[model samples]
Target: MTVNRFLIPAFAAALLGAFGLIAAAQAQTGPLRIEITEGVIEPLPFAVPDFVDEGGAGEYARNVARVIASDLSGTGLFREIPREAHISRVTSFDSSIAFEDWKAINAQAVITGAVTVSGDRIVVKFRLFDVFSGQQLGEGLQFAGTTQSWRRMAHKVADAAYSRITGEGGYFDTRVVFVSESGPKNNRLKRLAVMDYDGANVQYLTDSSSIVLAPRFSPTGDRILYTSYESGFPRITLMDVGSLRTQALAEQPGTMTFAPRFSPDGSRVVFSLERGGNSDLYMLDIGSGGLQQLTNAPSIETAPSFSPDGSQIVFESDRSGTQQLYIMPAGGGEGRRISGGQGRYGTPVWSPRGDMIAFTKQHQGRFHIGVMRTDGSEERLLTASFLDEGPTWAPNGRVIMFTRETSGAGGQAALYSVDISGRNLRQIPTEGAASDPAWSPLLP
Candidate 1:
């Protein structure tokens, strides 16, 4: 996200001098644009040459380039041309462009970079180009970090490229928190765990001694809220992700608290509390330690999610004798039903963009992960299986990560992600079965 606007003019001037007429024509024209609408789909072809090594950087340079290519290609929007098919090579960061070479290979975009390693520190500088236009899409940028953080640097590069081209934010530099499960289906052991957005650098936050469920990241990404059964009853607990310190919240005698989610401003939390065998939604001020009941319905109400602007909340309830979705003011008021369909809806999560809300729907003996607008129109099921629930939105709101469980004697749950357009459904690699994934915002 760190872009150098000043360098763009200089880079464009350099390209104009190097490619002459092609660059002039490109300047007269513009960068290639792709219209992402409901229609026929075609992935844009792009190339990333192996990064040149400087100051004896060696293998790190090539590996970083490979990771960048993989990240972009995995999005299903960009196709990477193989290195063997690359007609031109990038030998230096400041080298002149060979627009004809890339144009001949039918590449619409090209990424070139150089890597420098000094002891434990590594620096990667890259530039993106419009191959056909013969113009630099953006200014050259560099990222400096430790060698151990090379993957993060590569993700940063991919995110920058994706944003500049698609005119949208990227989710590459984020994390996911979920419950990792082990043992048999009948005697499952679950613990809270977290990892990079790509499922790398996993770190367990809690031991498996107690069952954990519905792990959620705070808006700031520095804390986590989840339901734990350590005391033999589900209770909401908030933990400092860095210190691994936890403190139980909404503790009451003979009461169970669960399904906790942070407010948009991280000043309060909304969750479900079961007392006298009835579950209802309640809001708790994190700093004041005060609680307020938001719903007084006789039916069960839970899975409340606050809108991005913190003015409203979307949640699930069975007030009509069937599970359905409802929206209400954040401060508590009459709820308006938003879901009207054949199936039962639950686990409604408001999208970051404030345009759509994702949910889990059950119909015809099948579970699906789907999304619809705030007014309950344009419902589209992204995936259908024996069980696909607990949809969590990416930071950019372009993708959803959810839990998919198989149906059988050995049924298990795992994490999966799909774009909002219902394409690129893929399973995220985890060390063990995982569920209830919550994605964090882009890292600082």
Candidate 2:
């Protein structure tokens, strides 16, 4: 079937070239594209009929397409035309396109795929098209994984589709590690939990027997660094994601270590160590068990995050008389202040792109999640509420997830995400109350 699409002027040329979009400029109909900006734009209308099951796949075929639909639609950039209104059904893996049929339903784009199962393995292949232009959007792609990895395979497909149209890296195939909270507000039990970015496939890493806070995924996504209270004090603990093995680091006799983050190369960890009455930043070499102090300030310095290249560290410090953001050499030095706003800022996290820094700010009794350029200019607040803190960037740095808490005795903390443009602010689905979300890099 045919679908009619219109390419947005803001991003059309670049997207057309990146994905090999075959729509001719002189054609009567254009290719579908979304113009991402701070303003509201109608989502691109698309359709995904159930994926064709080659053999013995049964529900896996339909489930894969459903997941892809969910992934794209959840971004608020695409809208799925319900299956009920579909006039064309995908009947075979290599069926011919019916561009006219899709165009009748006003679908700008269409996705079709096939699922094949052999023994314990599954392979999914997909193609996205601009139905109105009668041309495919991106190159053909397929993902192969074990039967148990079907969801990830689906996410990979969605990621490809999203990237081709938006000209931006996709975040669907990543995970988030956060603190899972339960029980009463006054005495909540906390544990380390990991889940898909959309909050599915939840797996707890540490039990609630000991409180876990600020779980950060390693650059490779194979390990985690977090602060644990099992030793009767906040100690930074490292855990192998696959084996669940835990190791305590920076175990000074009289100091407390917390807020640990991994370097871009995953060979070192930067954290905060509190001793006497002062807290400062420190870096630990993972292989040689070497330690180095990065700060010697009397005031607090914590929440250190490394730039993507591992050359600079952006952290929150009180050395400037009030909490603000600072950027220092990864080898340690007197960093310069970056945040000149009239607010107290903390929990500074560097974006994977190394172009922006996301942080939490408090001013006039309102908490906000905001981002600014690495040079500290063009600061923009993305969210504001009673209590918003702990900002984490998605793999592409296009979106940010942070913890938002309500006020009062029965206050609860939940996760929320917003585009860097400060649009599409919505709560992330969690089993219950959760906080301190850390997004892992895109899965390899």
Candidate 3:
């Protein structure tokens, strides 16, 4: 099912007020600032008290507070001080701040909030403070939604805190679409599934009767494009996420299409089409049902992705007798070879920031997830394993999630994520084996 962006009322006003407060406070006390570019060797210590229940929010208040703390701590840039070490409690949202008490516990930052539940609705308001300077980091903001959406509200609060302190966008408010697998490794059953960025709120989009691969979300997260073998051959299918309806795009009797991705505007798709035992890159206009061939060569050209501005396209080809990366105009022209490494590269994906491209490289019997500049300079391998491929970027372009498969008789595939800086590598929790992860853009 389709997941709509969370509606946080008065967010702009809150953000403005927050930044204004931070600026005023900075002028007065000049608190310590985090320079993200320099890299964080030590995580900043912070604290979060159980949010006050304004009007009987029940257990939701505590749970929400815990989730916020978890989100911040999971980033590897913040450390959560246990509540037991607290010298002062946040009994109310408007209570006087105890900067001294927090400082005694060596807490650099603190978060305080109140949760109110009325009928099925829930509202959460929170503020961030620099304990050392005794100043508010930003203006307090409130988020309101249904009780069932409490987790999302907590994530928003964490995102705001992350952005305000680090001066960067947050990726917590996004979703990932992937192929969930089960059964034996020899005969794995794969189907399309979607989940929260943290691997929560999982929902299946297709049954296992038909094998699915490379499930990609539209730019707006309202639709999905995937390759299915329902017709006994791989064919690209467009799906309305909310309705679970599917339609074939550019369907041809003798050709197969796969590895489809939506354009930045969500009005077109780029994919690989196979005909006569040869595969090439093609683009399709969704509105006009028009098709355009982007690449024509004897070598295979596939896994095409568009830059953030939609001006250029990146793909993989073996024109030089080895799979390598190439960049060309969005409309397709004489492509310039970009990758000159000592290996085969495939699945080149442009970052959301449009600064670098993440790809899968195979060399010396090992597979790695790596990134290179748009011109194929400063290449760095972020992960190496028995098998790691399909690197998809986080909403903020600071991290990548990909599929990792084990090597053995009982080997299986699972989803994994790694920071772009080559830190915080971890596996995403899933019910079973999973692969071909596709992360959607941040919710509205």
Candidate 4:
């Protein structure tokens, strides 16, 4: 995730000029009246029939079906009618569904799938239907792989059905790479952990011997870049997922660097370096191993993020007496501040849409997760709580993921996501204590 900041005076003038010409040309047209419609609406109810198994061989054949049901329910958009309420059972993919039975239970949609075992491979065929319209919504899908891959298959089927109906990409088929923490706060155990977006199939990529922070997924979802304290000091490292091999990035003496993010093209990494009692942003050329300093500020500057176009950089700095967001050229140059509100801001991250920036704002002793335009206009607060920091953007820019810690002893930190509309708040399960969650782009 990246944050964007643009100077107000120059940006506002350009917006007004562009709208003025369009308003004048439409003034000469005939008069028209616009009406606003209001009505009460309801969410559509759906039913997921129990997935049938032709041969009982793998545990995934039974477990994967329940996982898909939980994933859809967590979205808060779909209502899955229970199996006890199901009026008909689907035994084969070639059979027709009894649309009337589903309608009796007030189900607007229905999903059915069949699992079979062919030698060492697990085969699945699934279909989605609109009970109200009494028609198949889309083409059926077939997936074949080892039994361990059944969970991924279930997510892919759910993603396909969701995308076909809403015309938006599905996040269920993706994974999240976050830092898993354990032990006391002062001497904590941290490692890079990856799990399904729904919190299943958790795997630890690194051991707990070394401390890790800010694990970010590559744009291709095949690699990860993070800051590790493996060498008794903070250093940046990149890990290859397929080969499980990691190598140190660049070397800097007596300087601590953290908050690493990959470029939009995944060719370079930009991070923060603390040297001579000052912190600044820097970029490392992945191919040539060249070091380029990006900021020359005297204050603490960290949390560097790149714009979607890979032309500008947004970061947090305290050079203005308080922490605020600043924008500069990606190749290092003089920066301009864009946050002038009545508080301090940190963790400035840019949205994937290239329009707004998401960050954590502290005002009057309360923490807030908010979004502002590129020019610092239209600041909207999405969530406020005891301690909410580290905002990561959803792939579509409609949702934001962050971590919240409770107050007092025995308190724990957990991952959560909230939409920009201030609705659909959900708590994502973690194996243990978790923080600094980084959401991956849609899987290929």
Candidate 5:
């Protein structure tokens, strides 16, 4: 099966409004030439030599090199040359690189680096070479930071190399903030958990006493917005991720708020408000205590997501007697439905690329994953099954992370990823039954 990439109507309007000439020029320039398909194309081979330094940072340097190599290899797009396969060792940055040795091992790209340490500070210099073409793709770049930041520096280098080859943004240096669940479904213990993109370093930022859901990372990955039931009711909470210090947003008594998402600027959070008996979309100023109601309707209006430019919002509502997607101004205005007359669309999540919105559609007792343009056109279903919803975009927007639940037996729920082309469905490992998975933006 093939997945059809849907372009939100609002994004097309924004392109014509903001970059009319550039958009037109690109249209004339034709579609992107490179299309990744589901075939056994030879993986791009790469070699990452052990970084050496004059200072005795042996273990640290080796770990950094390992992280860089792992990040590149985990994308499923690159194959790493094993350390035992290396024929030559590079010790100095000025040493002549042996490109043939890397090519002989079927490596198309080679990454060489040197590490140095001064007190608590460390410096890392790395170069990326196109071994097949026998040319340097880019000049060597160096990073200087504290010893603890060495891992981050390695990720940065890997990201740069990945971008240079793929011609698209890289997500190696990203973090995923998700609600970690344990215990039974009836009395589950949940906490805010974060992990590296590769699931290597897992850390729980919050305890399991409180029930938290829908943890969204800010654009800078420094803060998170989530709905917590700590105060005996569902309320939006903002926390500085680096500090784990949290403060409740504007809360109303006898009301519940959920499905919160951060604005592109990270200055505000758009969420659904269930006040009295109605659900509507509201924007809360993340910095100030100001509140702006974006949707005023008796019908359910939930899952509001901001456009990348912070100008418009895509959300789901039931104004038409069935759930569907709608787009309105950031400050609230006349809304337009955009779900292509689907059965019932909910959990509409705007893609990071700002071109599409992934949503959950219920049709004939079955669930489907679909995308559509912002203005309610070109709705295309990606995946359909017994239960598949809560679609979250991979940082590059080429893939979607969602939860897949099985029926009967234990009714297991697990996280899975499907490429936008509806191929390469891979299951992401979790400690236990997991659902409502959210992907974070790439780390800066």
Candidate 6:
């Protein structure tokens, strides 16, 4: 997961629907929009009242509304008007709108919903409205799932409202895989764990008896690729996310594999293979067990990432006398250098949009997370600290999450995310220190 940030201005804070949003009538001012640049003076104000409990929903209605508000608020692009300040309540799911009431409190947008819980299933529906324009932002939609997936239902509602407001794809329905750490900093125990995008509902995938690093999700997110040391040497291991079944991926005797990432089609994996103290990039066709070396340089070449279309690969190499970024055809070929910066760059990750690459840069004794255009122009540093590295992109490619470690003997590492525009820098809450976060594609 890789290359890092540059400050592109006038970033649109899009409101993408959760599952989907059908374009509807527009307001006199058109759809609500905001530029999410640095130095936020004000956030878009929105209101979400407690959902109406159609039947047997009880506390679920309130909890769902809270989660929706939390998700939107966390973005730093929207602010939630407290429920206590609301002038009216949503007593009925299909009730008439109170635009004047919401506007009186300076709310530009409002979200209303209803929840119905049947025996083993739950149905949640929601709508977004532009208060001043008195227009529904999009067609109302509902999501159905088992009762156990209640939180995901809430996230869907939030995603819908967010997408409607922002006009971009929503990321609320996504999950993140990360390395959970415990014990002293000098004697840390690490395990692979998966959790909801908001850091909720965490589940351990592998025990901490053996070390794991750089866990990456498959294109469909049904599997994971990570470097494991269970065999007393680093090897790329593939695991079925659902059943926890595992297998070694293309591990040859006397060769170590690490930093593996799935190709766009999920049929191949691109990773770094080290042999005889030299590291290079290689591609493995998972279905055929065929291996192809992509880079044959004596210099270390690692952190290979496929472009969204899988036509090319962006990676980091020290072949330029210093660590830097390069791009090459998916097949074996010579790589063209894209990074010409003063500092060393590594961990180049192509954007989901296929227009940018995110990475970590070390400059003047300071570590920074940054992003650059695919051709290596418009470089922008999003974050700077004692140690910030290994950036992973959000499902929508609008945000990047990575490891931020504190300095000193008792230093700690935690997961942090920042918008590509460099605003909304936030620390993801975890039970313990966490790192190497890989964001999954939005769940189906």
- List, in order, the clash count of every candidate structure: 0, 11, 1, 4, 8, 28
Candidate 1 residues lying further than 4 Å off, grouped into runs, are 1-30
Q: What tens-digit string does per-residue lDDT give for candidate 6 at 1-444?
A: 111111122232222211111122222364454433233346788899999999999999999999999999988778899998999889998998988899899788899999999898889998888888787777788999998899999998887777666555789889999999998987899999999988999999999988899999999999999999999999999999999999999979999999999999999999999999999999999999999999998999999999999999999999979999999999969999999889999999998978789999999999999998888988889999999999999888788999999999889999999988777899999999999999999998
lDDT of each: 0.87, 0.87, 0.86, 0.77, 0.76, 0.87
Error of 3 at 300 (Å): 0.7
True-structure RMSD, every candidate: 6.4, 4.4, 6.2, 8.4, 6.9, 5.6
Pairs of residues clashing in candidate 1 = none
Can you write out model 5's per-residue Cα lDDT over 323-404, one digit (the tens) per residue? 9888898999878888767489999888887888889999998998877766666677778889998898878876678878
Please list all clashing residue pairs in model 5, or write none if there are none. Answer: 3-421, 7-373, 8-373, 8-374, 9-373, 9-374, 9-375, 338-376
Scored by lDDT, model 2 comes in at 0.87
Which one wins by lDDT: 3 or 4? 3
Comparing 2 with 4 on TM-score, the higher-scoring candidate is: 2
Candidate 3 local lDDT, 186-295, one digit each (tens)? 78899999998889889999999988999889999999999999999899999999999999888989999999999999999999999998999999999999999999
Off by over 4 Å in 4: 1-42, 56-62
Could you tell me the lDDT of residue 434 within candidate 4?
89
Off by over 4 Å in 5: 1-41, 117-120, 364-366, 376-385, 406-409, 429-434
The local lDDT score (0 to 100) that residue 26 gets in candidate 1 is 22
Q: Give the Å shift of residue 27 in candidate 3.
A: 18
